[model samples]
Target: METKIREAGTGCGCPGNNAGALSSSTKGCCSPPDDVSGKYAVSCCGPESVTARPAGNQAEKRRLDIEFMYLDLSVCTRCRGTEKNLEEAVSEVARILEAAGFEVKLHKIHVQNEEQALALGFVSSPTIRINGRDIQLDVRESLCESCGDLCGEDVDCRVWVYQGREYTVPPKGMIIDAILREVYGGPAGAVHAPSKMEALPDNLKRFFAARRNKET
Candidate 1:
């Protein structure tokens, strides 16, 4: 089969056409800020997908699936920063993985509502999963001013913990380490799959509800 890529929500209203500049007035969830180099842009107002096949016609190639799910890239600073870091990490490893006969696929999912969040088993805003496993298993969150402004209410976004240090935006090294571990294997008892959530977390529920109320 020929390699195919499908993307959705590529054209949701966002200021500056996905410019890197941060804006407190941006009105939607689909906007992804451009990186500093002006070379990378993620257009995700909804769910977006990309499948990159290895160069050469091989009958079959190993696949590496990466999913980035976020609540609001347009205004959520945490989400925007995480998205940038994730993209960088992927780019850094793309050539190496491709040369190793791995076909990389990335899915950028914008969780706009409670139902969507529940459906994706999303427990927090701005999550990264490699091969169906969350890069960080423990979910923690802190108040997000940008998102709070977007919805007219306070909201909590993800906080990444690496080596006992908490960061609002996940470090590139932490993401790279997770990817390498998934590809090359980690500790003997590492969790290889994401845990299922029965319901959307209350924090997310509040954010979604507040956003809906604001839009109406």
Candidate 2:
């Protein structure tokens, strides 16, 4: 199965970039927001463009080359672990597909308003989509951000309590595995590709893959 892709549209009642005008979406990073729209936009990589297929036309037959969109922001230091884990996972996948000679486009969602988040039906930050489908398996903990109270026993506003420990977020490995399962059309264990066995050139690569595998 292919992932779902979300595109930013014109004049969606959100803020505009520097020119004080509404600009179209750019790959890698989203345009800056002129006003706060209850959402955060992440600017990273460099400005590139990706073609968006109409939502109604997704079933057209084509080769299954993958395009990934990592919805995040630059100032999300509070969520760095989630972003780092996502970046590391994407890098490893890029290496694999690059070796296999398949092209992939990595885009960033610059959140400027609730519309953007709602556009993709995202429940929280650090959402990973292959094509456009959310691969993260677990539902995010519900927290009342405004009240600073746990929405449930283990669900705090921004933090999560999985077992005994309360954390700002879940481990990156767990999130990555969720995306892997969504992208590969099966559970991570079912694919069993030995992602760590792939020839990686750096510590982060091994670090993230090993962590993700451990989660699986």
Candidate 3:
């Protein structure tokens, strides 16, 4: 099967891209910034996904970071399920990514306030990001009864569309599809089973900004 790979991130190392530590470079990548602590500086941050290898290890090891951002995991069943979904997704192809010398790190972030959400560029709760980019960029903010009370009213939670079906929590396959895209970007086609990861929704940034302002 000819796997149609959908590339993720900004292809890395671009002038305008996030300067996270990664081995791969597209145009201009893998340069360490002078400042590592600043928000704009983009440090390796968490141990889950640092590109640097152990000193004297010799063998090249790539860092693959995955983050699952949610509003409040305790109050939201959907968000809780997403955590499991992500685990299953990563487990599906853990060896594939690892064999490619990728040290996989999975994390969960709780966005309790609007400020944190805005700062992190969170489109909605239950959002998943690989590297510094969203897995699926089509962010839908819909009323979630599960977390409505927690939001002080009816909260607009995140939604995902998988296999032509709408789901409150992302399907495991959707995440696997996304990981494959990042795993095999560009001319380096998929070495294993072919999978499809659809592109992000166009012009979603405008909505991200609009949503932030409206809620703030």
The C-alpha TM-scores of every prediction are 0.68, 0.38, 0.59
Per-candidate RMSD, Å: 21.8, 23.3, 16.5
Better of 1 and 3 by lDDT: 1
Best by TM-score: 1
lDDT of 1: 0.70
Ordered from best to worst TM-score, the candidate numbers read 1, 3, 2
Which parts of model 3 are misplaced by more than 4 Å?
Answer: 1-58, 186-216
C-alpha lDDT score of every prediction, in listed order: 0.70, 0.37, 0.59
* Residue 142 local lDDT, model 3: 59
- In every candidate, how many clashes are there? 2, 10, 2
Q: Write the per-residue lDDT of candidate 1 for residues 1-216, one digit (tens) a residue.
A: 111111112111111111133235563455565344434455565335222323333334566777899888788899999999999999999888767556667889988777777667777778887766777776777788899999999788888878877889999999989888866773322333434556766777898889889989
Lowest lDDT 10-mer window, candidate 3? 10-19
Top candidate, metric lDDT: 1
**What is the per-residue lDDT of model 2 for residues 1-216, given as tens digits with 9 covering 90 to 100?**
111223221111111111123346654335443324434343443444223332321222211222222222443333455556656766766655444333444555644334344444444444444444444334343332322221112112234333455455556555555544444553221212111122322222332344345457
Write down the TM-score for model 1.
Answer: 0.68
Query: Which of the two candidates, 1 or 2, achieves a greater TM-score against the reference?
Result: 1
